[model samples]
Structures are given as C-alpha cells and as structure tokens.
Target: METLETTKLDLTGKIDVVENISREDFLEFYMKPQKPVIIKHLYGKDAQVYKWTFDYFQKELGELEVGVFDDESETRQDDRSYKKAPMTMKFGEYLQIIQEKPTSKRLFLFNVFKHKKELLNHFKFPNIADNVLSFLPFAFFGGQGAETRIHRDMDNSCVFLTEIAGYKRVVLFDPKYSKLLYQYPYSTHTSIDVNHPDFDKYPGLAHVQGIDCTIGPGDTIFMPSGWWHHIEYNTAGLGFAIRSLSPHYKDRVVGILQVGLKTHIDDLANKILGSKWFDWKKNKTIERANRAIQKLQKK
Candidate 1:
C-alpha cells in the first residue's frame, strides 16, 4: 500500500472540549458563534452506551435492509461523500463484514430507529439546542479506515453527533473557505482529498485553516451549520447525529434552496450533460479556487 504523505496544512485552531455545559451557555458560546465543541457529559448519566455495541445491533436490528455507501465514483475520478449508494444488504451482514476486517463500506444517513422504535430507549436526546429534529435523527456507521470525503450537509443544519462506539478522526473547515476548498459547482462537497492533499494541484488548500478533532464513545461533538467536515473511522463504529435548524433565518432559507433547488438542478444537468457536466464543474472548481487565491494575495 502507498503511504500517505504528511499533511502540508497546519490546523492551529483548536476544537473546544468541555466536561459539561449548560444549554444557554452552549447556545451563547458554541452555537451562536458557530464554533465546534466536544461535550463529554452531554449525553447524561442514564444514557446506555454499553448497550450500543455492534453485537447488540446485529442481534436486534440485523435483518433490517439498508443502503450501503462506499468510496467509489462511476462518472468522475473523485470519490464524493454525497455519491448515491451503489448497493444494499442486510444490516446484520454489514455489521459482521466490518467486525471481521477493514472495509470501505459505510452506512450513511440511516434512521434505524424508524424500523425499530424501541431503539430510542437507549439514549436521551440532549436539550442543548432548540427545534431539535427529533423525527430526523440519523445514524452513520463505518468500518475501520473508511473515510467520508470532505463535504457539508445539504440541509445546512446544526449537527450534534454522538460517538456510540469506537473512535473517529474529524477535520473541519468553516464554510467561509468554501471557494478555497475548491467547492464544485452546484455541489455541497469538494473533491480534494484531505488526507494527502495535492498541494501542487490544489494550492488554495495550503492557505486554508481548519480544526482537527477525534472523538471516542459517548462524546458528542457539536458541528455548526454549513461547516465542511472530513471524517475517518479509526475503528468500525457507529455515530448518531441529531440535527437542528440553523439559528439564522437566512441560513434556513439557503438550506431549503440547497435541497429543494440546487440538488434537483445538479441532477437534471448531470442527466442531460452526462460527463460533460462533470468536466465543466471540475474546470470551474479550479477557476474559482484560483480567483479566491488571487483575492487573498491582493489583500
């Protein structure tokens, strides 16, 4: 296997860690400011972390059918997080696959509790944020070494992601640096590989600053709305995220447009133009990134 080059960028900014925080303080300090924070005690004492192991899931919800996503792209060279899942399998089989060996298979944006409502009894939702999308609680599962490429959620909502099992390394960038990250046209993600960034090809990445964090079981990380994140599963793990609306109304409007307008437009264009549309977006990403670099130089 080819060794990954050491990352050229330095993420000097720190992701705050707190043992505990009040709902009001979390709002004023972290949420309002759009800062990322890892809360160690957010889940409350009664939360059942031990019961969330892979064996338990496999035993209880094993027969549930699920869409499994992987790091493969058919239309382009870039493997994207938002790519449509290519296959489906029994939830138990996938869990067994990951448990036995490292694999690229990932279970993305699934609500397992929807199939078995009794699963919700394992944990209590934190009351730190308002308008918690209780009905939309989603779960993400990944095997060792599986990576979710750099991307932002299209819904543009604040995400409180709780690590249920194993460990995950996360790299985050504020949305303000979207152009520097070479965000593709009409997409919520960048094709740039954060693990071993090609500085020569994507020079704008060297100028970008970000936060790096690793979370273990029971830790909840607050991801601000529209933040770009790259996630790597250090070990096969499961994470649950409860999303809430962005505090700002304008951001909510953008989220609506992203899902209701931008997604459909991209799909239509891709279907009509095929590979030509991808080529255009790839070239446009470079052009826009160069402009962003030039603007930074002028300042």
Candidate 2:
C-alpha cells in the first residue's frame, strides 16, 4: 500500500459571516477572492420544509425515482425507484449500502432543486431573481466513498457548494497546481490516487500547496472558477452547488479557450495517442519538473 502524506489545513480563526450581503459586495470581495464563507441563516428559515433534517430528506427524496449506475453491466439506468431506502442510517450503515453487490444499481438523486422548492429558496443569492437563477441543483445519495476524480470546473466558473445534511471532505488546489495534477486527455484530471499518491512518479505534486476543508450541515464553501477540487462524502451527505462564469471579459475569454482550444487538444490527444499516451506524457512531465527543481535547489 502506498503511504499518503497530506498537509493539514488550519481554517481556525477563518472569517465566518452569516449576514446577508449585497450582490455587489459579495462579488467584489468573497467571490473574487474565492474565499470560503458560511452563512447559518437562510432565506426560508421559517418554512417547515426547510426545517426538515437529514432523516426527513431520505424519507421524502429517497422514495422518488432516481438515476442509478450498474457497474457490473456497465450501464446507466434512469428514473429507477429505490426499494430499500436507507436515509436514517448512520455513517457506518451508509458505507455498507454502497458496498452492496453489483456495485451498480445504486439509485442516486438528480436535479433535486426542481423537487424541493423550499430547500432551493434557502440557497437564493442576491441579484439572482427567481426566474433568472440560471443553474441546476443535483445531489448524490450514498456513501462518501464515491470518487469524483480531481478536476476543475469548465469555463472557470466560480462554484458555491452548500451542505444541507451530513459531512463532505474537499481537497482544493489553486490554479498554479494545474500542471502538477496531470490532467487527463479529454478530461480534467489524472488517474492519480489522491489519498495515496505515487510520489516517485509525480514528484512535482510535493510543491503544490492546497487548502482542505470538511464541511457539515449548513456550511457553504466558495470555490473559484479554474480551481481544482476533489470532493468525497465523509458521510451520506445532501447538498446543492451553484456555478457562475466570471463577469470579467478577460476571464470569460480564457474560459472559452479552455472549453474550445484545450478541450479540442485533449480530444485529439486521446484519438491519436490513445489511453497510454496520457500516462506516458504525465511521467515525462514529472521527470522534467523534478530535474528543474533540482537545478533550482543547486542554484
């Protein structure tokens, strides 16, 4: 087994403001800086539905038809109703639920905001009108074990992830860490095991500085666009996220380039070089980076 070494993040004394701020102020300070902020009070605080706990979420949302993946069959089944709903289970029970056979056929929630108006209203940010709130809300139901390979959001859109129930663990890296992440062809991340990384292969990762945060119910994390993040559920968690493109013209242009030029490059690389090519390029990049670092150290 590969031993993993991680630098612990100290968010102690970090600012926590729950007050409502104007749209202009939020965009200028918090959103631009990509700083994480938590607001305890919500807009529909008085709504009965908004008061529903994690247990209630499973009871109501879990019964509905959801999307499921069957790993053995390598197929996706849509709008499948769950039989044994495990919403009230503890963290341990949730882990067991994911480990069930077939590894697929796991019913996962989708577009939850359309079903839960009250919960969606609670996330309403300023300057975003009811009809004009241009985003979707989706939730993953199951253990925190499912891995969403490390990747940055498309178009460098800043993202806000608000947790409603349970806990989520996030590992975030700044834009400068992009090269070290060894983004895959036609995708945004490498196949590196983030928990137990291969330092001998990707030594450049040692120079990357990152911020880690574990969020709980009612906590919101603001991640800037283009910032690479890897998220895992520490427990069965329910949450929705909102993403917005940068308002600046220069940022928007770069975002377009990523989607167009970068994406095209990746597609071509995958077609010509095949899957193994990515691994080969990643190794070469790491080797070059190590040599550069050694030279700098001697200087």
Candidate 3:
C-alpha cells in the first residue's frame, strides 16, 4: 500500500458491499455469476465477532497447543497449509506474543470449533445456498503485517470468509489470470508479494485486473470458487471461512482431482526428486508466465 502500483492497475474495479440481500438476488447476481461481495454484520446473537478478543481467547483456549507458521519460505509445496506446521506453541502464549508486536508467525486452517463446538451457535449459514459443509469451518489468525500469499483454494470450493476481529486487506483476481499471477505448477500458490508488485520481473501482473478491499470486524466476504486471493492482516486479527461444494458438476470433479489426485502426484514427485522437483516447478511457473506475456504482446 505504501507504493501504490497504480500505473498498470484498473483502480475503478470494486467489490460490492451490501447490508442485506435476498436469496434470489444473491444467487442470480453473485453466486451463479461467481462474483465476490461483502455482507456487513451478517451474524446473529452470540456472534464471536462482538464477544471474542485476544484476551478472551487467551483466557479460554490458552492451554490449547497450536501449529505456528512463519513467512520466510519461498516454495509453497515445501510448506503447505495441509501439512503439519513447522512449529508449535500454547495458544495463550502465541496470543501474548502477537499482541506485543508485529511478527511473521500465523495460525492457518486451525479447527478451533472442533475443541469448542458451542462457538458454532454464534452464526448460521444464510439461505442463499445449500450444502454449507457446516462441520468443517476453519479459522485463520495472523499478526500485524502477516500475509497469506496469492493463491486459490485447491479444492475450488466457494468460501464465506467472516472477519471476527480486527481488519484485513484482501486482493482478488479471477482464475483467468492464473498465468499472469505466476501460479506454480501442481500447486495453488504464487511467490509474488502483491503488496509491492514487481512489474519488471512479473510483467503479466501489469496486464491483470483485480479487486481490492479491506474488511473489518463482523464483515463477511463471499469468495467465489477458484478465485485467487492474497490477504494481509492490518492488525492482529481472526477470521474463519465456511466452504461449500461448487454448484457446477464440472467444478466438483475438478475439486476432487485437485485434492484427491493432483496433490498426490506432487507429493510423489517430491519424494522421488527432492529439491530438483521444487526447482522444476519454479522454472515451469516462470516459463508459463513468459508464454502468457508473449501472448499479450501478440495481441
């Protein structure tokens, strides 16, 4: 944000914000069309968005041991969200540390609801869609300046990400820009620092258009399936997402392949080739991005 890369970006693009929406309108205009929108104050009574704070979590779940990940890594596969995190600590201590100052440490895909089921009573799924997958909601916690890299969910599920506390800045791009995003082979990640995009190195970024917005406490964002997102925590914060299967059968099949087949193939290759496999993936991403750039030039 310090260096606004506005020269190439279409600053007019915006994510719709609404206080209320009918099920029919939600489906017709947003969900079916695969567009993103922010719903303000979407929760009911007992909403954690109002009651939960760092102090509240430290007091209640402090003893819980949690996986902690740092922002130092370059390769996404070597340090994936599905894998066990590199470090662990008591949730209370982690909270205490983040409250003190900005750090790279973050909590990803943590199932806090598994330990405290009563928390589920805080929010209900809107009638806008079916198959909410209520049982598998996941929480993401990050300290000030912590960032989740640019990536799409591998399973390609629609995500209802609700910000329970603090503020977060999100930048989203359609999957059509995958090559422009420098997406890695066999992975859902790109190493680009969206905060300070280097158009010189990744020229395709200069050609892509995306929507950017900041969500505060109690705001819920509907992220369509397969959309790429990059998130930055402006303050130490907590948010959770509930996902649903894509309505399209073709997308459902791709989701199955992404989770059940594509990941396995990458794991096998990593075991067989070690560091060389990662090198190959990085080189392949660069090669693909260059091709996309060439195609743009021809236009």
Candidate 4:
C-alpha cells in the first residue's frame, strides 16, 4: 500500500474563519473553492446549546415516537448489517426506524428542522440565520460501537459535520484516490478496510493521501464534495450536519441531473438487472479505472 501523510487543519485557523462575512463574500471566498473549513464559534458566542450532550438528548427526547426497520425489510446488505446489530429505541423519531438490540447498533434521525424547531431557534446565529435556507440540520444518535459504511453524500454535496456528543473517527481521502480506494462502480467511495487495508489486493490505493481526524463535541469537520469519507461513532453520539451545493455552474448542473435523473436510473437498473447487473457494472468500472491507472504509471 502506498502510504501518504495525513494533514491536520485546526478549526480555529484563519483558513476556516467565516464569522462576519457577507453572503456574497462567503460564496466568492469560501463556498466556491470547495475547500474544507472549520468555523470556530460560528454557531454562536456563549450559546447554551453547545453544552447539549448525548446524555441530554437521551433524557429530553429519548422517549419520543420512533419507527424501526431490520434485516427483513430491506434487501440491501447495508440495511441487513444495520438490522443485525443491537439498537435501542431512538428518541423523537420523525422518519423511519428499525431496531435490533442495545449496545449493538441503532440510529435516531431527529428531523430537527421539523420536530425540534425550538432547539434550533436556541442556536440560531444572525449570519447563518439570514442564509438558513441554504443549510439543513439533523441530529444522529448511533449506539456505541456503530459504523456507517464508507460512502459519499448524494449529488456530491459538500458537508459540514459537527460533533455534538461522544467521539467519532473520521477518515477522508481526495477524489483522486478513488482508484486506490477500490470504490464501488459509479459511486464516490470504496469498501477498503481503514484499520487493516490490503494493499496487495488493491495496489492502486498507494497513491492516495488520507487524513484522519477524531472529533469530539463542539468540533466540526468540513468535507468537500466528491471527497470520500468514512465515519465511525466510538460511543453513542449526536452529530449536526449541513449539506450545501457549490455555486459553480458545472456543480449545480451535475447536482440537478443527479437528483432528478441519476437516482431514477440507479433504481431502474437495480430492479431490472438485479444484483447481477450491479456486480457487472461494478467490476467493469473497476477494470476501466485500473486500466487508466496503468496508463498513468507508464508515463
């Protein structure tokens, strides 16, 4: 495996500041570049909501109505794996649900935008409030020792993931590393094991540089679109995320096509060809990528 150094950029650094910038300044200076920035105190100054922790979530909203789905409901392996894991009842569930047991795996998707408007109002910042429509906030509660598969966001949106409670290990790689990462066909990411990578099986990954960051409460990580990121929650924790599209014309066009057409294509392809089609597409894409790599190496 090719080893690359991981760079750590502090959230408090000047590169990440966006405290009082105007909307035009933000779009021109920061949002356009797709560069990752950590805004310190961007949420607020002396905001008591910052003090809100996982325990508080469990206490205040844990008992709210929840919906559950398990292995039997979804045919996808991702769904099965999550169902097999143990999970507890999530607090204030607005969407879907599936539970297995405690301490295994569980997820609570609190539609904070719909259900907890009061909580959101508490942390509203004037600068962001003016542009609040540009962002969406949701809280995730994962049971201890839960893992989210390595995947990119929909429409290749840029993400700002803020840790509210507990700790999480994040692994990030640039889009150029896609081949080395053994990414899925037509997908933005791979299934390469982060803790125990097999370099010989996937030799191309050696060219990629990955940055590892462990986040705690009040810490935010900015991940650009097309960046491959994998997150693992060490303990039960809550995360707030905002996903936004770039102002770039190309990105906007691609985003619209992805949401409007590509999603339907995926669904149709899956239904018509079944798993065989998925396998064929995946392997063919990998083969093409590998061939491209070989050509590059010849230079």
Best by TM-score: 1
Model 3 bad stretches (over 4 Å): 1-12, 45-49, 72-82
lDDT of model 3 at position 69:
84
- Predicted candidate 2 versus true structure: per-residue lDDT over 114-215, tens digit per residue: 776666655455462122224565555544455444677656676667666667777777766566555543345555556776666666566566666677
Pairs clashing within candidate 1: none
- Model 1: worst 10 consecutive residues (lDDT sum): 73-82
Model 1 TM = 0.93
Per-residue lDDT tens digits for candidate 3, residues 77-123, read 43244467888999999998887899878998899999888888877
Clash pairs for candidate 3: none
> For candidate 1, what is the lDDT?
0.83
Clashing pairs in 4: 2-206, 67-97, 68-97, 68-98, 69-97, 69-98, 86-101, 86-105, 87-101, 180-205
Q: In candidate 2, what residue range of length 10 has the lowest lDDT sum? A: 75-84
RMSD of 3: 3.3
Could you tell me the TM-score of candidate 3?
0.90
Error of 3 at 142 (Å): 1.5
- Deviation in Å, model 3, residue 10 alpha carbon: 5.3
- The estimated TM-scores of all candidates read 0.93, 0.68, 0.90, 0.75
lDDT value for candidate 3? Answer: 0.82
Q: Candidate 4, which ten residues in sequence have the lowest lDDT sum? A: 5-14
> Candidate 4: TM-score?
0.75
TM-score of 2: 0.68
